[model samples]
Target: MSRLVDAHCHLDFSVFAADRAGVFERAREAGVESFLVPGTTRARWPDVVAMGAREDVAVCLGLHPCFMDAHDDLGDIAALSEWLDRHPEVVAIGECGLDARFADSWHAQWSLLEAQLRLARARRLPLVLHCVHANDVLARRLRQLAPPAGGLIHGFAGSPEQAMAFYRLGFVLGLGGATTYPRAQRLRRTVAALPDDGYVLETDSPDMPLAGHQGERNEPARVAEVCRIVAELREQTESRVAADSTATACRLFALD
Candidate 1:
């Protein structure tokens, strides 16, 4: 079996509430040996941390931009910094970034993102960004900060030119089920053009399901299907994509 990793997921979400254990077991059987769960809220940080304690799970802590309305206090950023200081299991700082698509207040979103970026830099940990239709703003901020340690752009659907900008800023493009859809022409093209060394594989489970399973909830086990599609697009074998992506993820998170 080709060893693989699901670089980003939200196992704490209620989608896996009934049989989370079974979901993980099925993922392992599919050759997804490790999973990274990123926290999106202060209250969920403990649950996220607990999930990471499981044999093959790793965790990242940060407030997601979608929940900007929820983070009224910037103190949560400090709390996360303290948490990172104490917890060795916490691998990175994010699932946080600017999302101008759904929210009305870009200032609040940018504030939260900038604070988290500072925390990640101070802690010397990588970031797990969640950018949505704001890659230009994201790229600009990343350039200004130039964090010594880099991170991954989860669920990237930008153009090849935009992707190259991120690559120049030392970020990895996280590819997932979005590229599997025949209708996602631009995304497919971007994924096809990405360099093997500049990408990582993810499922973003309970969210971006593969083409055939579009309406169904996604699971970590389906990452292999994603790899197969990516490999086909890149004109490479599944084993090669799986091995290279897993290595890229390991290096990003400093996994042993």
Candidate 2:
């Protein structure tokens, strides 16, 4: 419990707005040192950028697949360029990827994903990706584009082979609350067996709560619990898991 990073969390989301400072305080008390807040649409990038002013937090901006209809115009990509120019300290390009659950908007998702991939390449920043039942397409796209900064496939709960598919293409899987569920035996085993460098920890907060907190709002503090569960699953000390995953996120986001 020395030091840890919540590699992905939406701290700017409405759930934490009333007590965001308290959330950070609680997380730091639990050994969570830094939190990466990813933007899900152009509209929220400003709020995320505002949060980036805090030394302990990092930010990434992109249009999320589930919010496909919200991206009003193609110029949002241009707006993204403007945001990056104005906020060069931003860590990565993401929370972007395909969601098979939204297959009807697959074409729009592809267009946004492609543009963001290119933007991440141009910005020389890593990506925070989200894919649901779309690994093959995501893998193919990553292989084709080969982003130089690489990326993290956020909230990965797939098989080890599937995780390796992303690793082979210069991406890493993100392990989170998903590992804390007893029924997630396959995912837990996948997380345990992967090479230490192949993944980072996350919470995707206010969304994917851990097993016991099914109805409560997830805070970055809970990531410390995630670290413990990951350590248990991997049969390593929590300190080891904390250090390794922190290092992985630091490298990916170019955090000093």
Summarize candidate 1's per-residue lDDT along 10-89 as a digit string, tens digits.
Answer: 99898799999899899988999999999999989989998977878899999988887677546897788788877888
TM-score (C-alpha, index-matched) for candidate 2: 0.97
Give the alpha carbon lDDT tens digit for every residue of 1-256 in model 2.
5588899999988888899889999998999999899999888988999999999999999889999888954798899889889888888998899998987999899898899999998878899999999988788888888899899999998888888889988888888888999999889889888889888888999889999999989888898899999999899999999999999998889886
Candidate 2 deviant stretches above 4 angstroms: none
Clashing pairs in 1: none
Worst lDDT run of 10 residues, candidate 1, spans 68-77
TM-score of 1: 0.97
Instruction: List the lowest-lDDT window of 10 residues for candidate 2.
Output: 68-77
The regions of model 1 sitting more than 4 angstroms off are: none
